[model samples]
Target chain A: MDNNGFASYFRFSNVDWNNMWSATWETVWMTLVSIIVVAILGALLGLLLFETNGSSSWGARILNWVVAAFVNIFRSIPFIILIVLLLPATQAIMGTIIGPKAALPSLIISAAPFYARLVEIAFHEIDHGVIEAAQSMGATRTQIIGKVLLPESMPALVSGITVTSISLIGYTAMAGAIGAGGLGNLAYLDGFQANNNAVTLVATVIIVLIVFICQFIGDILVKRIDKR
Target chain B: MIEFKDVSKTFNAKEGQVHAVEDVNLNIPDGKIYGIVGYSGAGKSTLIRMLNGLEFPTTGSVTINGTEISGLSGKALRNQRLKIGMIFQHFNLLWSRTVIENIEFPLEIAKVPKKQRVEKAQHLAELVGLAGRENAYPSELSGGQKQRVGIARALANDPEILLSDEATSALDPQTTDEVLDLLLSINKQLNLTVVVITHEMHVIRKICDQVAVLDAGKIVEQGPVLDVFKRPQQTITKRFVNQETGSSNLDDTTVVVSELLTKYSNGVIVKLTFHGDQAKLPIVSEMLRQFPDVDLSIIEGSIHQTQEGALGSLYIQLIAEQQDNINGALEYLKTMRVEVEVIKRG
Candidate 1:
């Protein structure tokens, strides 16, 4: 095998180091911002969904229906199409729809609903007897939620957000495809479009590394917090 | 006193209107351990739950210390519940919290100062025999130890009434007794009115001063534990008493009695039931001496001690050369306050 020919095939010349670094940062920034927002939004929605699901009041029934429908509709939408569909809202919220910041609204909207479902499942996994015990202690509804439900279900909630964060990273890559300025954009414009296999290979490897790091941190956090 | 005035709870299920508790009037005096014993689905839980407002009566009212519990709702109901501590069969301790934290939970609900709450919880932990286990999580404890934590948590608020919803049902016999003893001591120490709901007759026989036997949503019999055990009017009441005394094995007793009866063709089999001070008396030996011509042999016997007194039932065979001596022995037992039921004559 000729060494020069192998270099030409694998590591094509003139790769822009600055552009690659900026794109990597953009991917990380988008993922970080989207996940934080998703965690908050998803947790509230999940709690509402769980609390109102079997409630007898008419107001709660309608609220449950509305929240459930919203979660279902948003979660079913593919992340790629969701970015285009959320363009108008993104422009209104972030003042532009061209870069990593613009991808935030679509990324959070698409992923929060998916994460909300996980959050709801995690709350459901809590023993009903534990809830009854809290009630028998004369805990008001708010106290039960604050002092008992949330703390008891913390490990599951952390693991859930971790899973959502990993998916958020993937969504950020998808957002990068349409000029959002992430590794996906670098891979697309410089690697695929310009026929630079080396750039695409490096971007894919970095994204995989980021996912592993996210999962590793999540596992350790869950292990440390989960007494059960 | 906690009074249930014509209290009845009905649940509207898909099947039909199910009466969980029907027309029950019970008065649980302060500083006494009251037990509501019944089989599964006998409304024992519903009856006790009403005392704490966990279940509201469909028709009547529950008055505890002059407060109408049935009419309360929202914050009022929650406040009433705070004064009436309840422990569950499953322990129901927060698995996430350590023993001390679990004990401090109701204090937190009461909004006690952090320092005071910790001190009170510390005292309660040792009171319920969970002193050194304060930092241990519920998962790290054994079944008996978990129940001790539960008892500590229930007493955290220094409640006037402690509702035990089959608290000992999940424990082994030995553990159940230990927990019962702790409850009995707590009832005396704090002078707290304890309302225990359980199907276990041993629980009633162990700690309860007064017992109400519930069957199919109604109180079939209710009285002092010793009195109820001495003369159980209903079949269910008799069954519960027999369960505790191991006399429910009457089938085996009958087989043994028949075998003994055939062997001793001239013996009289008599069942002697004695309660209170009479149980302590050597009535059987005294009767044998009174009728010295008669020979007595023990067949089967059991003694059960209740909160009120001890109840003992003994099955014995009296052999004599003459039937008149057996008859004389039977009459002598009656004068000694021993209830004698002649089982068979040979």
Candidate 2:
């Protein structure tokens, strides 16, 4: 309960309690915002990929190639390199390149394709018979996607986003090392640079806890929704 | 009535051109169960799918009432599909939905009002004998129960034609009969034209009034169920008939009959086939009474009741001191509208 007393016991000579709180808030905010955007964009991209995969139509084949190329290219890039590479786009979008907001472009761009691949696999795991049954019932393309594909693959989609969220948390930390203000920024600046071991340990523990919480919630959601 | 006029479906697969259905012509009268029986890959599935516009024929047309199903596309095709409900071998009930919800799916696609959909689904659930288990998910239901749900869902739209694609193939014999009974009752009660595609002759025998025996994308033999049972023209058709008659166990029957022949040197084995109303008569008893000197012994007997009438096959051994007595008994049976095949004689 006593923040300063807790800090002193661990020989936390360089620990700033106020800065640590702000940094934790920044990390949570970046992950939260980026994951929501990623879920939407990723799911749409994945649906398009799956729907167009085996299509014989000229339009669908071309769209499938373009979307597939974008996903593959973004997914192959290392997160750290992606952030550096997207700095110009980041500067244009956020008007600055040194805070949590500046990291959004790269965070979404990097994670969306990763989650999109997951989403496509999730859709593939659905029973083809279920889709056929929907078609037999006179369901339109949109109706099939909405009523059958999406609802049937909900558990997989949620678990996918949960995984993407955890990875986005890690990406936020990586984004932090380049002057984005988060727990990673705090740990790198105040712990590693200043030779303070306690600050690094505390930040690592918080990041681990966030990942655990995300996993726990994801498990419950999947269990509740997965009737199969 | 539904008609398939020179319908053929040839799929261009990776290997080459594959003819699934080859110039098949069929006439399925309204309000009757028509079966397309075949082994796997006989193109029965492809033929049935063309009725609902699920698979368009490569040539010719499938017309239900007056509408050519193969000629329609997009919304028009889909709307036509709404009128033709289909059930699968897998049941294909949505795992994410409850029994009632699954039944309401087609109604939802048709954009029926929620209250009306719920009422109609409830009625169909009861009709298919899934009355109390409306809240159960497909995973919680047994194979038979899931198929009951499938029947309920197929009937939700009150479709004029119900396409059953091996709907009872995955079920046990007892359950297959139960689903077939439900389909038969639906056909009668709703006047729905039912097209059943299956490899099982039991399915064709039990409910189908008319049957087309498909072999390698062609209808090798087709006629009324009783007529087919009485005389199967093709080898494949004979095999399907044997499936129901228990005649496929020919080796066992031969062993039993030959053993009986060995025991009685004076015995004569006659394989008697009784068709239609003759199966229910005392024709066998009359023959024995007329030739009282002959000893009558039944080896193996089976009577299958089809929609048209009963088809019975019996193997009888007649042992008499005089060969004339056995000959007289065989002649008497043949005169009573029975097909008599003399298996062996002393």
Question: What is the DockQ score of candidate 1, to 2 decimals?
Answer: 0.73
Report the lDDT tens digits of candidate 2 across residue range A70-98. 99999999999999999999899899999
What is the clash count of model 1? 0
DockQ of the two-chain complex in candidate 2: 0.72
Provide the overall lDDT of each model, using Cα atoms, as 2-decimal numbers: 0.89, 0.90
What DockQ does every candidate get?
A: 0.73, 0.72
TM-score of 1: 0.96
lDDT of 1 by residue, A1-228 (tens): 343344744664557788889999999999998898999999999999989989999999999999999999998998899888989988999999999999989988998998888888888988887888778878998998898878889999999999899888888888888978899899899877877777887888889999999999999999987877
Error of 1 at B245 (Å): 1.0
| Chain B fold agreement for model 1, TM-score | 0.96
- Among all candidates shown, the one with the greatest TM-score: 1
B13: Cα error in model 2, Å = 2.3
TM-score of chain A, predicted model 1, versus the true chain A, to 2 decimals: 0.94
Scored against the true structure, residue A143 in model 2 reaches a CA lDDT of: 91
Worst 10 residues of 1 chain A by lDDT: A1-10
At residue A26, candidate 2 shows an lDDT of: 98
